[model samples]
Target chain A: MTTETLTPEDERRFLDEILRRELTPSRSIAALLAGVLVVLLCVYFLLETILALFRLPGWLIDPDEALNWVAGLPGTGPGPVLALGGAVLAMVGFFFLVSALMPGRRARHSLPHPVLAVVVDDEVVASALARRARLAANVSPAQVMVTVARAQVLVNVRPTSGLRVTDDAVERAVTEELDAMGLSPRPSVTVHLASTGVVGA
Target chain B: MNGTPRGLNRFITGLLGLLLLLLGLGILLVSLVPPVAQAWRDFAAPLVRGLHGAYEATPLPAGSSWLYVVVAVVLLSVILLTIRWIAGQGQGRASLLVERPDHSATDGEVTISGNVAEQLLRAALSGRGDLLGLHVVTYQYRGITALRVRLFPRKGASPQKLVQDVESLLEGLDLMVGHHTPVLVHLGAGTRAMFTREERVR
Candidate 1:
């Protein structure tokens, strides 16, 4: 093995690339399914063409006849079936286009580290935030809901009857937890307190 | 971590989408509009006639059509290529991690397998109830072998705490191996944690 000199900045950039690729939402399923469909289509045409070349009975239809039918499709004019099929085809195409264009990011956040690369899923952050909010607001586990998004964290709290939970308390708790975690591109925290409180303590 | 070229997948998907979009829109327009339908018919009639003329003119030794034979070959190649493309996705899992030539001996070599890191890391992290699962694998990144540790943390588990704990364990691993190996710690929510509530004290 050979040792090559790499600067600290280059090493960080390389690690960042790996982490980003790992966290990106995979499009392998879409690619695989589309490839299979294409292969099947090609197989169908190949079989028909081979049957025609061999002068045998067409498995489904002769290649020459299929070509003629496609060429004659425009002569048939607009019909409900034709219009519906066209619409469906367009929709499928549009879906694929969107999937390809979108970045398709997963709900994960990478933390800054000197040598070790670290990534944490949003669900874990949400859970931790919810737990902290529940503790700070003096509410039950079910009374607090924390939703973590790409750039924001929404913490909703339902206080017990006769117990007032301040918005500042929940906000400060969530902020403190976020500070402890030190996630990159730190998410803005939003605390929503329900007007109506739960009945039992 | 497995090697899956996401950019290539997106490109192929985009190309396929663009082709289908054009073909479908062309069909829709030609069917809905009378003028377009007439134009298409005029455009396709000559092409179809020419195709038929060529098909008839080209014949194989066995009295079969050479045009269809050519078409069959092209389609077969397309199918084979597509299958190959699909098979190439998500590969490059490394089974061996390290190899060092022993200078003291004439022909001695030292090798380390990926399973050594996997089992050691798994045993180190197995005591934590907050983690739903743990997976450690080694992959060749650039020219160096690196360890990828995937931690499936239970709901309400603090990922920061988990990361810190794993870092310490990795330090121990570094001492055992006599050198530091690059590591990536991923704290993820696996399907079990997503669908089920696993916390007991919460």
Candidate 2:
């Protein structure tokens, strides 16, 4: 049996690769709605077909009646009505097809690496930056709000009275921490110091 | 992350969408153009008459109608079941089995449960005041086993410190397991209130 051993660098690279790969969100809501609609339609058709076959009162089950309805639809009075119905059907179909084919977008940011790629979630980055900002400003976690976007990180800090908090220091600290993270396509950091301070110990 | 829609769903959606689009376009075109409308009516008359004649000729017997109803119900049930199976493609067990890298017949296979990993993580994170909650889920991606560590930090907790502690614990787990399992840490805010002041009524 041949065994392969990974060096430290190899292990680090593997870990980095694992961190880079993100799970794609499954648009279950759309799929579930579509599935439910299809099931409901099938159930309705089943009931109608069964009722009609049993010589009972049923709506829109007879093939002959359906064909007649189709044959009569073209000559139905208003041209605008027919056109509008057709347009609605076409638009619904178009949107359904597009959603079925499209993939879910990943809410992650890629970090720069020489031999390895790393991707971090936007929320995770925001939490980390918020923690840093809170520490740098010496404020409670509730006082600091961090928002991490594709190309920017916004930090809003609310300091208490008699406490001196420098926006530049907090901004520099957050920026340095982000830089140390080595995120690819690093986003610009903006720090905002709110004028009003909350009354609390 | 949830997996994308399966091939069967995509195929079904495409087929249904195309059918609807074509039918709608055909109806709109026939309604707008008089010549097309005339042509369609002329073509549909014979087909409609044939259908009507067929329906008239095939008069269902009193008791035999029940058989047809049963058949229709069964067919519809099958179709609905198929659609449900296709839609439920991604939800499966997230745990992965641990196997030795060496292709040795003498060595046996080992299975690692996600529950066990979670317990291990819980033990590692015990006594941390800043942590609100920790959850560990195992996922297999492209044949690699990964442990997704979800962390909820208490209010005012330093995320960097928490991450460092989790990283060290992961390293320790790797050493103990005799196999390297990469950890993916997801940090989020704690849902619990940090401090609740009690009202003092005189």
Candidate 3:
């Protein structure tokens, strides 16, 4: 009988590897939105065409009228109408092209590790870091704001009155904590201390 | 983490984008050039006239009420299917089966339910002072079962320490289950804490 035991190092390595695969942005939301829009438009046009075929009362759209509108474009000899239509088309095309190319949203980050894979969500990272900053600054949790980005972690500290919170101290604390996590492609840490301190317990 | 969009979705979006870009450019060019516009109009005139003529001449036959019904049913079916496809676009597999390394012909495979995994995680991690809330969900990743652990941390909790504790808990879970499963830890801010604190201070 063979049994498998994963040491802490093995677990760490596994997490590191998985993180890389799981952290990248997904295009699912964009795809779903686009798919629904296209389907609705197709259904609308198909319904209209079918209604026109049946000579229904609600079939206000005339194929002849649409065709005539297109046919009449040349008679007007390149006016604002054609330009506006072209511009609208161009805008729509640009939107689609950008959506196709743009990375939708950064929801998670893959930690750097050679053997193990691990992915952590940005929100989780932010929350965790916020707690760390709050403790280090000796400020209320609400006074600390943490933003976790792909390449950077921004910590904004609003110190309470009578508490002297230095940027270097907060920065060092955050840096050490982040370093201990052993994040791959480690993001740089930025600590900002607001000048005005909030009055709170 | 959510998986990437399906291949078909990306392809369709790319195709639509390319088509729209080309159509827009062509329209812009035609609008700018009088000669090109004239050519386009001349080319489109007969097609437009033919389409209108066809529409006028092809009214449904007087006694073909059944034909309308058939067409309506087919169209409705197509619409329904399209809607269903759209709704299911990004859904991922919910459960994963634990693979058996050595099995006789009669041995059966073990199935891991996502909800069960969530319950196990909650049972293991709940009541920790550092954690405000815990949610566990399972998703298929790269053809294998993976768990996503979303944690809302208590204010002033050390992020590094919280992560270490979570890792240890997961290790214990893996040992108990007899198979190692990938786990994703998501740390999120405690919304309730943030809002309540703000209201109190105000």
Decide which is better by TM-score, 1 or 2. 1
lDDT of 3 by residue, B87-112 (tens): 65545555542544557577665555
Query: What's the lDDT for residue B87 in model 2?
Result: 57
Global fold similarity of model 3 (TM-score): 0.73
Ten-residue region with minimum lDDT total, candidate 3 chain B: B193-202
- Report the error of model 2 at residue B187, Å: 3.2
lDDT of 3 at A196: 92
Ranking by TM-score: 1, 3, 2
Model 3 over residues A1-201: C-alpha lDDT tens digits? Answer: 122335668656556545644554345555666667667766775676566556563355654465687775645554768777887887777777677776554566655433324455566667657766777899876688998787899999989988899999889888887887766568899998999988865
Question: Top DockQ: which candidate number?
Answer: 1
Root mean square deviation (Cα) for candidate 1: 2.3
> Of the candidates numbered 2 and 3, which has the greater lDDT value?
2
- Highest TM-score among the candidates is held by which one? 1
For model 3, state the Cα shift of residue B143 in Å: 3.7
Q: Candidate 1's error at A129, in angstroms?
A: 1.0
Q: How far out, in Å, is residue A84 in model 1? A: 1.0
lDDT accuracy of residue B73 in candidate 1:
80
Which number leads on lDDT?
A: 1
